[model samples]
Target: MNEGDDDISVDKNEDSAVLASPEVLETSFFINKPSKKKLKKGVFNRTWLNWVEYKSFLKEYNHDSSQAACIVCNQQFSVYYCSKAEIDNHIKTKKHQHHMKSYDVNQQLIT
Candidate 1:
């Protein structure tokens, strides 16, 4: 009928077409699968750290014995009783170093 009425109908048709498209429907079923990463065993595997060593640097995280949180930086880490490499790597991070420095300063002030 009117030019404006025609444009309105065309827009509605396009919107409906997009909503009913098979591709749009199929997209709802699409899911991204996560890839599983294989962890390489470190050389220190099978050697567990004693409580003194563990407590010196890490604290129990989330009440999970298998996970540890750094005492200085509060960074969470997996406890591989078999390996010390992971713990060593975390301790060597710049963030850990910075936090450790701050912790030492605080301790000095407290004393």
Candidate 2:
């Protein structure tokens, strides 16, 4: 075989040896353009002032450091991490009956 013919064959093989399929090559699977809705307008959001009407407790305790304190039991806590509902769980505990009695006595004096 002639050396020139071998070179031509090697060039043909190189052209045919595309590692990626046409689907992979034609479209970029990397960059994602932002949608018109997301880019065009600011999202409607409740400000802190607006939120205060509902999450008043969050404002009272300064948001991040806030703990939900049980009004009856005086237990200050991060409510999300707490295993059980405060008032319900407290009612099941032995001390709850004593607290109820004390609370009744206090209410009587106020009346």
Candidate 3:
């Protein structure tokens, strides 16, 4: 082969060696990706419960303060008293509505 061909082959070999190196391969495969931002705690308004009045509607699940389970649907939600929108949305769900109806029927029967 010519001198130019020898130089090209050397360059290609050097590039192949770098590409096949363990450090480069490991770095490419196991990259340290940025983690998702965690939600801020205790930022909710203390008086958030006043908006929807869910205290009588939802009961605490297993006595855990962070979770509120619907008395009607039995669906649990992560509640911060300030998250009235979340509570309201869940209450509006079809499942919640169905359970509410069933609960009413049972209550009527009991009385």
Candidate 4:
């Protein structure tokens, strides 16, 4: 076949191949959006009755008894519900000195 005919066939094949892929139908400025709800202002909103529900959620996730280590001191702690106050206390502890140092370093970097 002539070069012109060969080029046309190749173009046709490519067009058909692209048409077979469903994703090709979607044309937009693509963004990878988060699937999970992000915590805002360090507040986990729950009513008094919902506290029990939150506890159930923790137990379901097997995190009820799990302890997160203090970022500053590397001290082990079981956290039922995490809060800014708890984090502040942990940050002040001797165990968390390293974490606090890193936090300061990061803050400096950002500034």
Q: What's the TM-score of each model vs. the native?
A: 0.47, 0.34, 0.46, 0.26
Q: Per-residue lDDT of 14-98 in model 2, one digit per residue for the tens?
A: 6766588877765655345444553322221234225532232212223433344434455454434432343245456666567
What are the Cα lDDT values of the candidates? Answer: 0.64, 0.45, 0.65, 0.44
Q: Alpha carbon lDDT of residue 93, candidate 3?
A: 89
Superposed Cα deviation of residue 15, candidate 4 (Å): 99
Where does candidate 1 stray beyond 4 Å?
A: 1-56
RMSD in angstroms between candidate 1 and the native structure over all alpha carbons: 14.9
Residues 10-94, model 3: lDDT tens digits: 5643555544668788887757766678765423334543545565357656766666677777677876654556677888889
Candidate 4 lDDT by residue in tens digits, 1-111: 776564544564355553434564343323454356654433322331145422221222134333434333435544445643544465466745655567668878999
**Which structure is stronger by lDDT: 1 or 2?**
1
Model 3 segments beyond 4 Å from truth? 1-56, 80-82
What TM-score, to 2 decimals, does candidate 2 have?
0.34
